[model samples]
Target: MAPTFYHRWPEPVTEKSGSMVQSQCWGWKCLSFGLILVVLGLLVPLIIFAVRANSKACKEGLLAEQECRTVTRLLELQLAQTRQDLVGAMGEAATCNQTVVNLSTSLEMEKARGLEHLTRREELQREVEKLKEKLQKASEEAERLRKEKEAWSKQGETSFGSSSKLLSPLMVPVCLFLGLTALLA
Candidate 1:
């Protein structure tokens, strides 16, 4: 006959079943823990990177805002300075215009005075010419009168000479009257 398989003691079914169940439970727990660890690892770096990016963006925005404010302040200051310069230039131009007006007035006054002086000088020159003419006429008249007197004196000497008795006293009076008439003429 074939060698018969000997029947040994029966396997412990409860123990084997319990041990398998425990192993399966432990495997699921280990898998869940590993998955959790992986997720946390990924999330930690992502969160850190996001925070760093946000911080950099905030810093850049703040710097830009500060620069804008500075530029605005500089523009305002430049505008104010330009306004002041314009006002000063206008004031200087006004002063120059007033000076020009004063100079014009002075020039006009000087011209008028010059004209008056010229007129006065002309009038004086005319008066002097008139006086010279009058003097010349008077001198000529005096010279003519002197010449007539000399002629009468010569006639008297010739007609009445050296003989007061020959011409009588009556003739002497007549001769004197004639001499006076010639002198008057």
Candidate 2:
């Protein structure tokens, strides 16, 4: 009989060639089983190798991840420290600025006081100069009056005694008033 396909599987041969068909079928079954075994043997090792490589890669990835996490934590700590330092520096700067402002204000007040003192000193100097001028005038007037009184006394001494006594008393009062005025000056 001619070979024919039956559901993509070889139909069992009839009894016209019973032993030959049986032997060929047995041979085919042995070959197919051996091929399957060979393929399985090669694939099992390949799968095992793949599994081992995958496991190793996963372990390395986990280790790298752990290292990354540690680095991230360290970086975060450094960032926090840097932020604290910045805040402290800023506070110091603010304090310095306030100090500068206070010093500037103090300097301005001192300048104003210095100006007022200078004006007061100048006014006092002017008053002192005026007093000195007044004292000089008074001294010159006193010298002139003394010379006039000496001349009058000499002239009156040769005249009548009564006129001399009257002139002496009047001159004494004028001289005493001038002396007191000079002392005050």
Candidate 3:
């Protein structure tokens, strides 16, 4: 027979050649798949770590913003309270000033009344002094009249011894008249 296709490409040679090529191709394919799997696994963890870090940063920023807002509200409240206190203090000071003015006016009125009373008291004292002087003069005049009456009665007694009994009777009448006049005066 002439050289056939099967004979030229013999069984042993074909088997050996095809087996080596197939094994090497299959091994290289498996190594490529393993490398792909490892790269995918590493990417999953890295993606998870990056997402957690970003979330944590966002939460911190939100917390800081809330704190700042709370502080701002507190400061506003404090400022308002201070303003109210200042207004109250000013009102109290005005009321105190009015009270002082009223007290000063009352003091002036009281002083005027006291002066009027003092003037009246002085006038009454002068009237009392005048009455006392008049009483003293009346008492001195009464004493002088009593001494004159006593002297006239003694003269009548002395004259009665030398005169007649008729003269004695007339002298009694005269003495009676003088006594009456003195009492009347």
Residues 1-185 of candidate 2: C-alpha lDDT, one tens digit per residue: 99986676665667866988888899999999999999999999999988987897878998999999999999999999999999999999999999999999999999999999999899878766776676566666666766766776777765545565566567657756765674455
- Model 3, 107-142: lDDT tens per residue? 889999889988978876776566555544554544
TM-score of 3: 0.41
Per-model TM against the reference: 0.45, 0.53, 0.41
Residue 20, model 1, lDDT: 88
Candidate whose lDDT is highest: 2
Error of model 2, residue 175, in angstroms: 12
Query: In TM-score terms, which candidate is top?
Result: 2
- Give one digit per residue, the lDDT tens place, for model 1 in 1-185: 89989888966769787898899999999999999999999999999988886897877998999999999999999999999999999999999999999999999999999999999899877766765565555556545645655665567875544353344445546545654554344
Kindly report which residue pairs in candidate 2 clash with one another: none
Superposed model 1: Cα runs more than 4 Å off: 1-71, 149-185
